[model samples]
Target chain A: MTDAHEIRHEIRIATGDDIVRIRRAVRTVACAARMSLVDRTKLVTAASELARNVIGHGGGGTVRIERLISPSGVSGVRMVFEDAGPGIPDVRLALTDGWSTGQGLGLGLPGARRLVDEFDLQTVVGEGTRVTVTKWTR
Target chain B: MDRVPILKAGDVLLVSIQTDLEDRTVMALREDLAERIVRTGARGVVIDITAVEIVDSFIGQMLAGIAAMSQLLDARTVVVGMRPAVAITLVELGLSLGGVQTALDLETGLRLLGAGPLDGGPSEAQDRR
Candidate 1:
């Protein structure tokens, strides 16, 4: 919200195969943004975790990827994952490590948050969930 | 889903993962490995992930699950060649991969399994090729 963003990609998160595709696409954008190897790996890992969530809990969703540019000219990447499935009942519990509403290890939401610089989550109990993560170049 | 090739070298069953794995692919690898272990009666399993770019919780669980399965089949498992960033992220994610051994690379993984003090019976994880 500080400066500007360029939309890069929109992907469907409906199958296991899409997990790989989502990671690859996020990786492409991250690399193009000149992120460090560690940064790229972190962002991609986070993307994969979220995509799996969309497939597992959300029952399918959409991922929107964008490139961020600050007023000072620094660059970054942002990924928004929106799911129309059952929204979380407790955001705090969902963020807790080792907790899960599904078969996963309960790391997806919390783990993804740590991998990026900015983390935002919005959800309505019956409506859906939207998770946006951003990683800015230092 | 692309299947990771499994090769046999002496008493060790080697698996070099070189692709972005989906959940189904990991499940397939697990089944394939379990069957291979029983079929060959291998003494050790070495999984090289040096080329792998990341290890989210799901993939981390797959690695642990494989090691556990191999242990049950009387084969020691060693995961090798993890990138530094992957290591950092896995730790941050709270997955220690409990009960699975790790090494710097293929040779070290093989050696660890060969001399591994874990449950698998003693044998040379020899490279016959």
Candidate 2:
């Protein structure tokens, strides 16, 4: 049959159009990897929320996607979004629900983190913000 | 954030959501929306969320609550023009609207509520039942 290398793909895109493109790209990548429907939906949702945060709060950012091969022979996906905007002044407050600076309930980051298996975030006031999320399937 | 009045045009009520819908504002909006649903006895309610860039867990919960109240009040509640990011965030947060209807845009939202755009002053909508 065919080689396993034929199944992998990656994506990199800007956070524009309020994160719609990012979600579509995520869905395409996840589907091609043959992820479960539940996992695919969750992954897409997580990507969408994170990308939106970069656009709305961070002003703009970049999104990167990668295919991961687990040590146990499982296949999964990882996505990272980076922004060099005003950055978060208070990361802890921003992560809390009902703590939105604007009209939302502050559920974006916390919600995104919950949907994926691995989540990491790093931000600096003047530097920028980076978020990494991963989902696994054996 | 400026609080808008409940827009009544016939039996349908239009509620506008701005970019600051957190905590107390969310609670207030819920109570206000419920009151309008009861007072107008409208057949349908359309919540325009075009201006909102995010829809966090607390707001999501309140929306679901509004939908339930709408059913009990004999009115249909439809959320319209939700940004893709907001939709994703809500789903990721394990927040489901359950009985509430969603539309891609305001036009569809109003249509789902059985209301058409009126050219003149304001349109009219009344409860069928």
Native interface contact recovery, all models? 0.76, 0.28
lDDT for each residue of candidate 1 in A51-107, tens digit (9 for 90 to 100) = 999889888999999888877788999999999989999999999987998988999
Candidate 2 lDDT by residue in tens digits, A27-132: 7777766787667767876776687687677777788776666666667788888889777898888877557776555677877888889998899988889998
What TM value does chain A in model 1 reach?
0.94
For model 2 chain B, give the 10-residue run with minimal summed lDDT.
B120-129
Stretches off by above 4 angstroms in model 1 are: A1-7, B115-129
Model 2: pairs clashing at backbone N, Cα or C within 3 Å: A102-B20, A103-B19, A103-B20, A103-B21, B10-B124, B10-B125, B11-B125, B11-B126
Candidate 1 docks at the CAPRI level of: medium
Tens-digit lDDT track of model 1 for B77-123 = 99999999899888877788877899987766866766442345543
Least well predicted 10-residue stretch by lDDT in candidate 2 chain A = A1-10
Please tell me which predicted candidate would have the highest lDDT against the true structure.
Answer: 1
Give the candidate number with the greatest DockQ. Answer: 1
Clashing pairs counted in every model: 0, 8
TM-score of each: 0.92, 0.57
